[model samples]
Target chain A: MSTGAKKRIMREYGECMSDTPPGMKITFDEQNMTEWEILLDGPEQSVYAGGHFKLKLTFPNEYPFKPPVVSFKTKIYHPNVSNDDKGSMCLGLLRPEEWKPPNKVVAVLRLIQTLLIEPNPDDAIEPSIANEYKENRKEFDKTAKDWVKRYAK
Target chain B: MDPAGQHRDMMYCHECHDEWYRDEHGLTCPECGSDFTEIIEEDHDPRDHDDDDDDSMPDLEDHHPQHPLHHHDPFQPADDPEEGDISRLQWRQVGPGRFSVTGTVYRTVSPHGQGRDDGGANALGGFASILNNMIGGAARGQPAPEDAVHRFSYTSSARLAPRDAINPQAHMEPVDEMTNVLVGLMATFGEAPGGPNAQHPHGHPPHANGPGGGQMPFHPILALLNGMRPGNGTMGDFVYSQEGLDRIISQLMEQTQSSNAPGPASQQEIDALVRKPVTTEMLGSEGRADCSICMEEVNIGEEVTELPCHHWFHHPCVAAWLAEHDTCPHCRQGISKHERPSNTADGNTGASGVNNHGQMPGSFAMGDGPANDATLVQENWENSGSSQQDSSSGGIGDRIRRGLFGPPHR
Candidate 1:
C-alpha cells in the first residue's frame, strides 16, 4: 500500500476509535493495519437480537479509492450474507463499480447495522434464504434466530 | 489359480500381439512385458464359438460396419458411391461440452445399399433442421427452434449415437448453399470483431465474410472448417456429433453483459476538472472535513480538484479514481463530454487555464446555488442509483445486496 493509503487507513482507524458505531468494537493492528477485526452485536430490532457476529474488514492496496472487503467470520443466517464458509458480503457500495473513494469505513459499519436491522431480500446473495425471508418470514426469522443461538452465541 | 483359487482370464497385449493366461503371466505381456493388454472375455472370443463362426461374424459386420475390425482406415469408405467423393462432416466432442467439426472425404468403387442411404438421409435431415432453426431464428430475431434446444440438451447421449447416423452424402443437392449457410451461421455467433472481446484461440484474426451484422465476426469455427480439405467436391455436408451451438450461444450471451459495463473515463475528461483551494464557505457548518479519497484534513487554502458535480477531492486522489470510472465519487454524475457549460459562466470561460477554474456549469449555475447544492447532489445520487440499477444497484447497502446475488437476476 502507498503512504497515502496507509495514512488514510490510520485516520479512519482513529475516527472509528473516537466514535465507533453502537455495539461494534473494531480491533486495528499497527503491524498489519490493512485488516481490522470487528465484533458486531446483532441489532435489537432484528431477528438476530443478542447474537454476536465477528466480521473482517480488510482494506485493499487502493484503500479509500477501492472499497474495503467485508466478510462474516461468524455464521449468520441472513439473506444478504453467503451461506458458505466465506460468508462474504458483496452488495451495494461493496461492488467495485459502485464504490466511491469518498465512502468511509464508518458508513460501511452503519450499513452493516442497517442490513442487520432489515435484510435487503431484493438484493440477497443467498436466493433460497432471501426467498424464505420473503415468502416465509416466520421460517426465516426462526432459522435466523436458531443460527444466532447455534453459531453466533 | 495356484494361490487365489480363481479362473484366469486370457489377456492380449496390443503392443506385441501376444496372448497369455492372466493367472500365470498377469496383465502384462509375458513375452514382450508390455502393459498395453486387455482381458479377453471367454464368451466374447470369436475362436471360442467355431461351430457357427461364419454366420456370427457376418452378422457382427452387418450390425457394426464402421467398427475398427471392419474398416481399419477412417478415410476408407464403408460402402461405394457411384460418382465423386462423399464428404462426411465429422463432429467430435473434443472436450467436455466443446465440439469441433471437420470434413472427412473418402471414395468407394461401387454404390452402397438402401440402409446406408436411409441412415445418411436421417443424419442429413437432423443436421439440416438444426441449421435451418438457427438461421431462421437469427434472420427473424427470434429464439432458436425448440428442436435445436432438444438436440442440444441430449448432445451427450447423441455423442453415443450409431456412427452410421452421421453419413452426410444423402443431401448432396444443396452442397454449395449449405456450405455458405454453415460458414455464415458459424460467423454470426462466433468471436466479436477487433475489440477487447475478441479471443481467437488458433491465432486467426476474425474473417470478414460475416453474412449477419457486425456483431457476428468469423471465429475459430471458420478456422476449424478451413483446416479441412473436403476432397474433389463442393459437398460441405454437416453432422453435429455433440452440439456446440448452445456453448457458442451461451458465450455470446456472457459477452453481452460486460459489453454494456461502464468503461473508464477518457484522459481528456479527467484533465478538464477544475482545481480550487479549500474554503470555509465550501466546508460550511463543521468548518473542517477530510478529503474523502485520502482521508486527510483539507483546511482552508489547501488545493483540491473539483469535479463537474461540485464534489471536490485531492487532485491525485480523484484523478486516479476517474481513470477507472467516469462518475463523480460522491454522486456518480458522469463528467460526460456532452455536458455544455452554462451561459452564466461565460465571463469566466476564457481560453486561459486559470479562467476556467471557477466551476463547471452544472449545479453551480442555480440562483440558490450553494444552499441548493446539497439537494442537487441528493437528486444526482438518485439518478446514479437508477442508472446503476440497469447494471447493478449502487450504495453500500444495495452493493452488498447485489454482490451477494451476483449479476442482475435477469
Candidate 2:
C-alpha cells in the first residue's frame, strides 16, 4: 500500500508486460533491491534479428537521482556496445543527463529498446566498432549479427 | 562709780572679763587671764661660798656640764639673765615670754679627738671602719639589725587584736544582741519606742523576739546548703552518673537521627514534565516529506525517531525504515542499526518488499522492482563468476581477462 519508487516501478512493469512481445520479459532481482534484468527480442531485419539480448540494470543507492548501469549479457557487435563482452550496450538512459527522479523503470526500459534499434556511433563505447560502422557499415553489421547469433539465444 | 555698778564691775576679772577673786600678790590679766610672777634680783660676791648652802652654789669652772638641769617657777624668767653676746657666756630667751632659755654650750677643738699628735686621723679611721663593716655585712646577704627589729617587735605590735577586743557587743550572743540599746532602755522605763506598732504597745511583741528577728541569714551557710542539693548537678559525681550520662547520650542520638531523616518526597504533579509531540516544523527542516518506512506524512502528534544527523521520522517508520538502511532516510548519513528496528537486516528486508506480502519501498523505493531485482541478480552472478575466474588465473590473468572480457559482461 505504501507506494515508493520501487513499488511504482513494479506496478508499471506489470502493466507494460500485459502487451509485451512474446518471449521478451523484464523483472527485478529477487535478492537485490536495485538490480533488474530485461530480455529483449532483436528488431526484425536488423543484424540482431531473431536474437534474445539480455541486459542488466544495476541502480545505485541514490536511485532516479542517478542513472542505473545498463549492460548487455548476450554478446553482440555494435558501435555503442563493446564487442569483446556479451551484449554490453552503452545507452543514453544510463547517461548522467538523461536520468532524473521522475524517470521510471518503464521509461528506462523503453530507452534501452530504442538504443537497440539505433545505436549512437558518435558517443560509442567501442571506438574500433564505431570506426568500422563509419567506414564500412556492411562489414560492421555482418560482425554484429554473427556475434549476436553465437552469444545471444 | 556708783556703788551697785562698781560692785557689778568688780565681779568680772580684768584679763578674762569674768568674775574673779584676787587676794594674793600674783595678778591675772583680764583679757588673756595669765598669772604674773613677781621678779627679784640678788647680789652675789665672788667669795660667797658657804658650806651650809652647797646645793645653791654654782659650779662656775665647769660651766658646760654633760647634764645640766635648771628649774624655774611658771611665768618667771630664768635667774641667769644673760644678754645676747656671742663671745660672752650669756643665756638667751628663745620661747615666748620666759618659757625657754639657752646659752653658749661649749666650743670643741675637734669633734673626733683621738689625740693631739694623731691630729684626729685615728678617730676618723675608726668611724670609717665601722661604716665599712656595716655595708659589707649587708652586701654579703647577712641579716641587718633592722630586719630582726621589723620581724619581732614592730610586726608583733602591728598584728591585729581579736574581734572581741575591738567590738563593744562582741561579748553578747549575735542573735540576742539589741540593735538599739537606747530603745530597749526606753522600753524598760515603761516608755514604748517610736515605731509602726508603738501605739499598740501592749498588743505588740518584743522587737527581737520574732522569728529570724534581728538575725540576718548567713550567706556562706546558704551557699553550702544549695551546693549540697543536686539541683544544678554540677558536682563531679552527679554529672558523671550513669543515669545522667545515658540521658545526655539519648538526647544526642535523637537529635542526630531527626536531623538525618530524609524529608518526604513532595507530590510532583504531572503537568509540564510530560513531553510534547513533535511538530511539522521540527520534521520539515530535513526536507523529508513522510515516514521513510510507512510512506505516510509524519503527523504533529506522532512520536518520532530523531537521529544524531538531525533527521526525524515516525518512530515505527524509522524503526522499520532504518532496518533496511543503516543511514538517515533523507540524507543517507550513517546511523546505528541498533538504534532503530528499521536499521536491522530483518526490518530492511521487510521494508524492501522481500516478504511474501509485498509492500511498497519507502524512501529507498526503486523503479520497477521486478526489473531492478533481475538486473541486480544477473549483475551479481556475472561479477562473482568473473572475479572467481580472475583469481584462478592469477595476477597476469586479470589484465589479459580484462583485455578479453572488457567491462563485466553485465
Candidate 3:
C-alpha cells in the first residue's frame, strides 16, 4: 500500500482501537492491515461471567466512510446476539446512521463492553431466549450462565 | 238621464257599420267614424245579436223578486208562496239597457242572544245558513261549491254543527269509551303509590330506591335480577355478599386510576431478556472461518480481502457481494467502490460517493488501485517534511523521522 493510504489506515485503526477497557484486548492480525482480533471479558454480575469472548473485525478499503464488520469467534449465549456459535451481536450503534466517522475505535469497543452489560431485548436476534426472558427470567438466567461457563471460554 | 242606458246606445256595432259603408273588407264604426279593426279582429260574441233579436224578453221589473226599491202589496207578498217560502231573486231591468239583482236576506241572532233584524243581521245569517247548509250537505254526501273563493271559505271556516243540531246521542258513546281507555292506560303503567312489589303476594323487600325505582324498570341490573333464580336475591344483593371478587375489582380499578406503575420493560430488564445462546449460523458468513466461495479455510490459506469498514469475505466473495450491494450487510456502512475525492475536480463532491447514475460501486472496488500514484505522491509529500525533522519538533515528527530512519533500527 502507498505510504499515505497506509498512514491513513493506521491513524484510523489507532483511533478505533485506542481505549481498551480493563479486561478487553484488541489488535490487528500480524500479517494483514485489514484484519483485526478482539478479546472481551464478561461483564461483572452478569450471566455471561467467567467467559472470554473473541471477536473478528474486518475493514473495507473505504476506511472511515464505512464501518468495520464484527462477528464473535467465540460461542456465547445472548438474546440480542444471534443464536449461532459465532457471536453475532446485534447492535444498533454499528448501523450506518448510528456510526460516525469521528467515532474512535475505542468508543466502539467500549460500546461492545456496555452491550455485554445490558443487551437490548427489543432488538433480539434470538427471539426464543427473549421470549423466555420475558416469560421466565430465572430459568433464562440459569441457562445463559451455564452456556457461558461451558463454551464462551 | 240614465247613465247605463246612454252608455249602451253609444256603443256602436262594427259589423253593421262595415255593411252600411263602402264594401271595403276593413271594419269601421258609423257612429264614431273610427276604425273598428281591433274589435272586429277578435272573435265577436254572437249572443249580442241573439239578445237584439229577442226584444220581447221577459219584463225584468216583474222578475225583481227582492228589489228594495220595488213596491209589493203586503197581501200579495204573503200570498206569493214558494217552496219552503224562499223567494229566488230575479234580474231587475234597472234601465232601458241595464240590469241588476238582489239576494234573499234573513235575520240572524248573536251567540250572546242579541237579535239583529236589519239587513246586516240578514247578511250574517245568510253566511251562517250557507255554512250550515254546506255541513249538512257534506254529511249527506251532497256536491259542494266549485268556485275557488266559495270552496276555500267554506272549507276553512265551516265547523261541524253542534251534536244537538245533528244526532245528539251519536257523540256520547265514543267520548265515554275514550275516557275509559285513557283511565285504563294511565292506571296500567302508573307507579303504585306505595311500591312496585305491593301486588306480589309473597312479601319481598319493597323495590329499593336503587337505579330502577321509578322510570327505567328494565335496567340491566333489573334484567339480571329478573334472570336470576327467582328465590335468589337480585344481583345487587349477590354483589354485596361476595367479598373476594369485589376486592379484586376494586384493586383493578385503583390500579387503573393510579396509572403510575413502572412500565413492563426497562433497559436492564430488556438486557436480561436477551440472555440466550447464539449459534454459528446466526453470525452469518463473517463467522465462518472457511470461505464458502472458494471452499477453503478462511483464516488459514485463503487470500482474503477485508473491507476498511471491518467486514471480511473472501476476495472473490466480497467482489461478488459488492457488485450487488454497496453497503456492508452487518454494519450497514456504505462500502462503495468509488472514494469521495478530496478535490471537486475528481468529480466525487458529495458525501454520497455515488456516480452520476446514483450507483456506488462496492467497497472492494472503491480506490483506483491499492497503490495509486497520487496517494504515493501525497505520502511522499507528508513524509518528506517529517523525515527531514528531528525529535525536538514533535512526537509525530520524531516518529516519521524514525520511520524514514527505517530498517537500520530493525
Which sections of candidate 2 miss by over 4 Å?
A: A1-5, A19-23, A84-88, B1-410
Task: Find the number of clashing residue pairs for candidate 3.
Answer: 31
User: Alpha-carbon error at A7 in model 1, in Å?
Assistant: 1.6
True contacts kept of each: 0.50, 0.00, 0.00
The per-model lDDT (C-alpha) reads 0.55, 0.38, 0.38
Q: Give the candidate number with the greatest TM-score.
A: 1
Please report how far candidate 3 places residue A144 from its true position, in Å.
1.4
| DockQ top scorer | 1
What does candidate 3's lDDT look like per residue over A94-146, in tens digits? 54323323233444565566567665554567878878877888998898888
Q: Per-residue lDDT of A1-153 in model 2, one digit per residue for the tens?
A: 233546544554565576453446877665664677778888775678888888887766555344577788777777776766554554443554223233345545655554566655655778788788779999988888887778776
TM-score-based ranking, best first? Answer: 1, 3, 2
Better-scoring candidate (lDDT), 1 or 2: 1
lDDT (Cα) of model 1: 0.55
DockQ by candidate, in order:
0.19, 0.01, 0.01
Between candidates 1 and 3, the one scoring higher on lDDT is 1
Give the runs in model 1 whose Cα sits over 4 Å from its true position.
Answer: B1-261, B339-380, B383-410
Scored against the true structure, residue B297 in model 1 reaches a CA lDDT of 64
Measured by TM-score, how close is model 1 to the native structure?
Answer: 0.48
Give the lowest summed-lDDT range of ten residues in model 1 chain B: B145-154
User: Which 10-residue window of candidate 2 chain B scores lowest in summed lDDT?
Assistant: B147-156
TM-score of chain B of each: 0.31, 0.15, 0.13
